[model samples]
Target chain A: MNLTILIVMAVLTGVLGSPYVTDTDVTPGSDSAGMSAHPNSVPEAADGTEVFHEEGVVEEEGVEEDVMATGELNPSHYPAQRAANVVKHYLNTRYGSPYRWVGLHKVHSANAEEVAESGRKYHLEISVQEMTGNTTEKCSAEVLFPALENQRSPQVQASCEALLTANTTAQEEALYQQYRRNHTLLSGHNLPDSYGHIDPDMKPLWHLGGVASSFVMLKESTENTLYNMAQVANVTQLETENDQLRFNYHVLLHDMVSQEIIHWKLLVTWSPAEGVKVLQMEELPKCEHCEVPPKPN
Target chain B: MKALLILIVLMNLDKNKCFAFLSFSDQVLSITAKTQEQVELLKNVSTQYETVLWQPVSPEYIKEEEPVHLSPSAFAQSFASRFCFRVLLDNTNEMIELQTRNDSTDPRSSSSYYERYHSLEDIYYWINRTTQEHPEMVKVVLIGSSYEKRPLYALKISVGEKQDKKAIWIDCGIHAREWISPAFCMWFSLSYYNQNQDITHILNHMDVYVLPVMNPDGYKYTWTTNRMWRKNRSYSTDSSCVGVDLNRNFDANWCTEGASDKPCSEIYCGAFPESEPESEAVANFLRSHKDSVQLYLTIHSYSQMLLFPYSCTLDEAENHNELLVMAQEAAQKIRRYYRNTYKYGAGGKTIYLAPGGSDDWAYNLGIKYSFTFELQDRGRYGFLLPPSHISKACNEALIAVKTIALRVIEKTQAPQ
Candidate 1:
């Protein structure tokens, strides 16, 4: 066989092995390519200084070395930890939940297998890696979960009603937490650009943008416990002179009680003079004419 | 007063004559023919608003054959006779008696008779009775309350069970007008109690929860004013429109596709995911029990279909194989039992992409098995599934559910 064909065949052969095989378990000694033992996995030495391979695939001699190794945090670390905690708390609070795979199909059948595979992928993505990375960094805080803290307040209900009617909020943004957690289990689906930035690993980290939507405040003001959804659009991320990344995103906000809908598209870029700034809001022109309707006489 | 008098006269007139004759009441004599014609121009309106009814014109007027229409006792007898085993109608007879008509234009409303389901009370009564009789396997819980403060209840059924067990949830009536959706849940519950021993074993090992009438206010309104409302009656102060499509109100790819922001639209997704009280209650409940909720089935109507999750987008899910196999098996069982053809595939792939749906939301939350069932004939009957087909449809659905349940028990048991 030709070299190209031979290489392709070899790669396929390597991939087709048992799925349960782990990276470290499969690749040993000189064969290790991209495997990196997590910091927690490494044993602590007598001194604070620790020796490690720059390439994550290998573990070399450990000696007390003085080098600032400031690695960027795993994008999924914060959200995943929070999610795990939240889920655990959820289970504890509710006692227990009923489980179902695919309610309509029988097991060991074609559809059942597909469902099983989807579940497997779900674990790999959410439980293991961040599937949806930061799609947009224009927002200051990502909206993690949306909940009405004052569940019985009339004003909150009225505001929700207003938002619902105006069509300002999209349902997707409103239920970001539920959808984000569930998206991993869904068949292969991709996240929108506004939520997070795509890392080298292709996983979307949670941009502060998603966390902005679910803010709850004891009192309504410029700032409080719950931040307003519109504030995220005003946020801008910094950039260096050589490599400047621009962010364009779609933001959806909905108030259930008032039936108000608010949708805005934002573009933000970095500039040496201004540091970071918003370029445009796509929905401004469209919404200019959509003034709030007059209340009944 | 004058309009009322004329309406009464029209009601008294022979049905055929009323259609043929356009009466110019002397009181309305001042108006010109153009104006008078405009007054009588309107023919039929949806189940919500009031409208004038026209007499049948030959073939058009001929009423189609009604499906199975059994009185409460007769329904019981029919179930016993048809199954040739035990019929569990007494357990859910109150629900059968609480009937609502699918025909909104009919002057004779189903609510006037003993058939239409009037309120959440009626639905709960039936669920409670069904579970009570089958205490060995069934248990009930009041999950939460609706926007209008109606209690939302879910029935858990298993043959050999205790409360602490893995389970599947089947929620119906997201769209209020689809009466058959809730009926299917009732039927499934009853069947688990009365039918096959295998199902009993599966239930004993695994719990099955059913939510009938997710949108109670809209459902109650369907019985009272309108018979075609497809949303929850959550009051929106900004606009006169007062409902949100609960089915389109879930958090799965929520507003991405096949949904509307306008509250008046048929497929209006609420302002946000879990924005409505009904959806929030369900979501909170599910979130709390995320690990145990292995399978989720949201029942809807008209189309005979079995759909999987990720309805918000046209992407394959992680558990596509297992879901596909299970779906096929369920479809096959349904066919064998009732000879009904059910189309099965991924939600986004099989049908148009729909966001903010329960099945998709449940799937996203790591419950690998999520499905939406559009029960009965495609659209000939629409939400108007005849009473005649209830038993057969229920039986078929039960078989399909059992197949899934048994598989779930096996899968949950097999290793991790």
Candidate 2:
């Protein structure tokens, strides 16, 4: 932790000069001469949130030049957008893998504030997309841009565990054991068998496909793309390497915006304790009769 | 008409005490904090004009360009400058008025009847009146009473004499502030006879149990005290904070991530699973009917998603594929018909990993086909889905309900 910390408080509209805004503010404070406060105020802990009063570095009163905030920010605007952009980098740094590309799908909310000594800090609640897995999470994070003198990767504080998991090795192990016991190298032509239905036994592979593809998606995605795992075109389980089970998968990526079904082949490895790791990705030549969604998002 | 007048007077008498004296934020605005200069400018405005943030819950959460909705004091409007403020609500007081509005209308006008958001008193009246009108199909089953002693009414919808048949259990308004959820339940019941083929077909093979307003105490609190109130109105004797998140009071991985153990936390799991009477009532009902109930569905709002079991863990449900397809079909049906997109997947994988969810609990209880549907307006309107959008939202939900229920029937009742 740095000795001098920065605090960016968004939505402190009436308490700009004040060091803090508490529940007491909801009542028309005596300081407010004419304005009336909200009478039907939310009781403490009633609104699915804990008051953002953290036990962090609290500075002295009267740092007049220290704070900056506007309650909400435009998603398209630079400050908020850049904050969202940093989260993409943060996820890649934390959960990045081969064959997976991650990016910000949408910004639910973004706001920025500049504090003294350090730099500007942004509090953002955003949805992150793991492109290959076709999975998304609405994650709330804090990103701080340091002062010019203390330049570094934008300091990020986000708990995006949905895209990354380390504790589920038990489930992975059990599945791996079951797969190994089958003796023959598992291989399948299509995940859903073309009936838009995955066989009971084949469901786990489909899920792992999504998980492995997330790495590629995370690597290649951006603010503009909305990707979906259209199918596991074909997958063949390779011989076990040490402890991990390796598989070669060809999957279809449907770009919802362009309504194009793109094909790619992935070299993925999985083990119960360790997790799905994409070894490589290769984009195959486009097929002429690739099906298109009637209405793509 | 005379009875309706008395109900109105009673609702007013109830509201005029403590609640009527409440003051509300006149206008709510979604504003942008684009730069340091803009943040300073907003700080100056708040210090000068006194606007309060409606979203983000507190000022500490504000960041550059993080979408924060501000309930700027009417006083701030004249002097507010520099920030590009997008108006979200002119006056939340007006919205609150409609939510608690009690008006007499001809039941024949289905539009007027189903469109308005009803008060606790209004919903009870509707349940009684509807049961009387449709004596053959609808029967009110009192599952249990809330902490405040309000009877939890579950409407059992069947076509004829109830015989041993498969059942589907759906409980709504579990979180209280989710008024749209209870509204969907009412809409679902009414449409059972709306010349709706899907509802009729499901009722042929399965009896539907619809519990509207599961958390009556919390639901009533939102009307009388806090509009954004979630959780039930129950209190732990040791803690000052009132209420347990009923959704998180189930037995499946109780008090895990996305849930809190502290009594004051919003998603606080009760002292133990099934601790809250609301969750206990629903759990007991499902347990007793575990053999016959083929499916379970719970309703919530704001984010449009069809979620199935295993919200407690990252691991896939034993029937993950089956549940996912059912939810997918439901979402696709809504999209194809109403043109609204809905994300569908495992509750843990699709959204956040919220433990102690009813859907997961029900699935663990052997009800393989379980779901939680979050309905309407991704984040734009959120829980305060307006009355104008009520019909469309309800119809979209109805499509999903029918699609899933029909699918369950096919899978369970197919010629063996």
Candidate 3:
């Protein structure tokens, strides 16, 4: 369990984002110029409205031409496109998506002949479209697992129950292992204070039966969170005609570990596909001729 | 003269050896008093020293610089009436509210205020409001948190049912200095749901995940202190340097080439493969969703390129032909907009081999449709792409991404 937690934290940190530590003397509105720096001022945009600053443009105009001419040489002359609209969309959406590698030289070299002949450069973009070929039956949450979101429709709940009933043999060990790894349940390191501190060493010594799922709520006012338990009262299963599998999780107001009034709630529904390995460590391959030479690069 | 005589005596005593010493700020003396043989020998020694001093420092110290002009968006903001374009289709008002925070421009010799653009609070407010307005298709998720505890978010674009849908992942803002990456990522999300309404078909079939900024810490740092930070702020106890090139922190081939081990280097690979938690988080998420995530698009900037996998080595991937074709098609679409050209091909074969790249890693992990896009005007605008071009770059990229997404879906749906 501990190893799983450590692995989960490691993976979570990698997937979610890296930690940022900052110390700065500059205050957002500390400048003596105040809000009057711009002649035209307006209230901040209402939700969904794009907010644009005036001075940033003026500054951009002054340097755009110069940058276009010499930016290649200097590289510092580019502009920053602040698209609040796009960011807003992301903050409202979930599931998204680095790294550098070499093999660039060989690829470029191989394509050089083709590129020269065509006098054209290449690019790759992905466009996903819904398929009309096949269909899958909807599943209900109550039928599939131990619990369901409070607000889910009866029909949807029924579908999930059906999914759970069909897959009774699907043990909860994999799911628990995955969750533990994702959360670093056994890692000795304490959870970051940002997520509401949890002692890595704290052991919850109890048998959680029937209840096949869990939700963690961090207390805002105090250093306490709420953990709710429920037994699977009823369930139904819906088997999909297609080979693909999917599932969803739910979080309710009562799931809050704290009673304080918070601005919002985060509900995550995770569905791990069958036969998928939660965590696998693979050995990195080496180049047969890749020798560690004394090339001072 | 006495010292010279003594030196000569010492030299004679040690007959086989010879040496000449010169000191003080500047002194020019003739060796005419010495024998021709001695003079010639001293001249040779002096020439050797001159050659050594003239040798250029190795590893060619070429410093990188950002585009000098304010980006087009900044231009529009300055002259709102003249250059301003509607950033969002939902924005009916002509006026734009300006945040009066100097966090965008405060340059303290000591501290960096990387919190430029809108603050996190402002960003969240904007997202919340946007979702409230358009709750039908736009679902938001705080995918992860940055080093500073700022939430990393993704906007999911889906129409009808989200179950069993193919997923495409687009992450921007990996190199914090490349501010445009996040912008493009954001812009694409808005455009998909707003301007391009037919995208519902695309969304219905696939859930598109867009992460605007991956390296929030380094990105904030870029705004505040160093304008060119290209890594995540990960502290190494062994060194004072506090960052790792997130791009080089993936596990594809796990740091073999086109990366640096030096902590101070811009492209420094972390202590180990997947050393940075942020990269790990992203990798783990993608791995978990590998079945559905058919297309992995990691957006980057300055160089308009559409790259694919096997970045760690020169070997061609199993789907090399398909990836190359897709890349070529996308590059051509980008060229139609402007004279700007973009290169596309396999990662290793097109450019330098870079190990531990996310795209390559994803490709290796069964997500064959993985791509890394380097967007915009060759190097003209570089990281400081103008706002005006943002639409062009984003539009071109959007077209390309949609094009590839469509292609991949068609291929997937085709007779197996």
Candidate 4:
């Protein structure tokens, strides 16, 4: 009876002891699996700069708790997890936006094992929902995480930096503030209202052009302020010469009372001699992908 | 029961078959063809992939980089790359879908003019209701019937002493896809009834005749069958093709230049001058009331232009200077009020030489202030101006029309 029991125990152990076993404990210094086993694994930093690492075995019960604690899986834990984490981090840091996580897909490759062994590409597709003004925008981004630890952070940093530099809303707001200051200064000085009579000192930044057709200057006594809520959506530099710079900016204008929004492309040519001249302003056609955000109840 | 089931299945099959030819994936490209070769290439590619040209007369009008809208399939990508173009609208289907979504607004309950595009039936109902509600000022006159026997109605709006007053004849939707044209007419009529201060003098001095939809069948077809159909639904001698461009079927310069004889062409002038019953009926009515009709205004869209007679030729009209001065003044007034620019000149020089225009015909018939307004946009949305823009478009046109009408009244009142 003892011999028979020993044989049965050996058979059971054999069945559950393989590498493909479902409940195998993650061993230390094993590069194949586990978050803490990676060569570049570092402890969690207070500034959220270091790559993520999870302690203990990746048990079935712990997965949900781990996900909740970390917001997402640690990049070093799984080959696909790195890409998704990088993309999420990139969007979160870049826009500082509240977004709905739509989907994350791990792209399969025939040479995935080899690629992971080389510590190179980890391809993933991620989708998120964002709101621009009143419109909800669904954006899909494909991320390919680089293997080098030093390069990874810089890649994300570079992308965020590029987006920050090209932030048109901030630029337009600055320009508008400058315009208002100039307007106040000119009005205070009591300049003439006719063409060619603008103050020479203020000619570099602001000049009098025809008011856009879609905008109406309301009477001050009406208490209905015609606020120029305009944002530069896009800018294209058409020509650059020694003295003059010609550029076109697509601006989105929104009215407070009417709740009317219109997109217009304005061509502007600037030079020291000519000051700033609005060459043309035309309304852009409606876009299918764009939607006005719903009013909050 | 089996027969009914078979009929239902067959109907589904028929619907699927119709959609097989109509691709929802087709894209609308705005090509600025500068050379004859590029224009010819466009025509060639159009043959392979189904295309609908939107602006300018034809391929011949591509000399100065004129904008042309072409709906081409993905297969034409290689052909499209050879030319310089902008994707004005990506998907034609999506555009139509967007324009037609929940567009039904009952004109009765809506105190303000229904800004969204309305169906033909809704427009007709609005017309009938307006006349019925204001029997004193509004009178519905059945001008004629379309080829499909749709009654052509015109509203004669006059508040008081209609006998001796001069009249301003305003017609819209001469080309069916120009939906804003008809919308302007409806808005103008409603605003006049409400005694809009700008047009109050014009209404008090003269009667206004508004034929809101000239080509009813074509307008209905645009809503139902094809969104881009531009002519009246009149069967030609050839049984395969249909429609006659009513603007080109008028008597002035009849089929001379910038018009076609082919039945399949968009600008096909009919078999003879005033061939389409719609045009013939309008011409007959104008002829009968030539003495009282001092000014004729026909509204079309996409180009902000106010053009006067002689669209058939380069030659100036006898009252060219007077018409030019009046149009300039009207444009200036519109600019000052709305800050929108409107180009004004003789039709042939300002726009294209489209021969048989109603304005030209009216000018020939002795209506000195005959003008055509290409309203609102400058070819950005082309024929599809959204409902939100209706107020602006109508307001600007209102200011210009009031200016012209006041000028016409002044010109007529001055002693010879």
Best by TM-score: 2
lDDT of 4 by residue, A1-297 (tens): 132332222222110000011111111222222222211111121112111111111111111112112233322222233344344344533342111111112212111212452233333333322211111222333443334543433132212222322233553445434534442222211111110122343222221211221111111101111222133344455545554455565544433222224566667654433434456777777452343322111
Model 3, B35-118: lDDT tens per residue?
A: 444334333433433211011121122112210111111112122222111111001100111111124332321111111233
**Cα lDDT of model 2 by residue, A42-151, tens digit:** 21222221111111111111111111234566443334545676676666545544323455566667777776887777889887765434456778898777766664
Candidate 4: regions farther than 4 A off? A1-297, B1-112, B414-416
All DockQ scores: 0.01, 0.01, 0.01, 0.01
lDDT of 2 by residue, B1-416 (tens): 32223223322321111111111234445556888766666655554555665556556666687655665543453434445554333234323323333456534222245666777898999899879988888899999999999999999888866599899998889977677899888877766744233455688889999998999998887676544467898879898778898988999999887788887666788999999898999999999999999999999985577888778886889988887778777776665445556667776654456889899999999999999998875432345554545655776787788788889999999753
Interface RMSD of 3: 31.6
Tens-place lDDT per residue, model 1, B344-386, is 7676655456788888888889888788887774332245444
Writing each residue's lDDT as its tens digit, candidate 3 over A1-297 gives: 132332222222110000110111111222212221221111221211111111111110111122112111111111111011111111112111000000000010000011322221111111111011111122211111111222221110111112212232233344434443443222221111111122222211111110112112111111112222211111221122233221221111111111111111122222323321112112223221221222110
Candidate 1 docking classification = incorrect
Q: Provide the overall lDDT of each model, using Cα atoms, as 2-decimal numbers.
A: 0.45, 0.63, 0.42, 0.54
> What is the TM-score ranking, best to worst?
2, 4, 3, 1
Candidate 1 scores a C-alpha RMSD against the true structure in Å of: 28.7
How much is the lDDT of residue A122 in candidate 1?
10
Q: Score every model by TM-score.
A: 0.44, 0.48, 0.44, 0.46
Docking class of 2: incorrect
lDDT of 3 at B406: 76
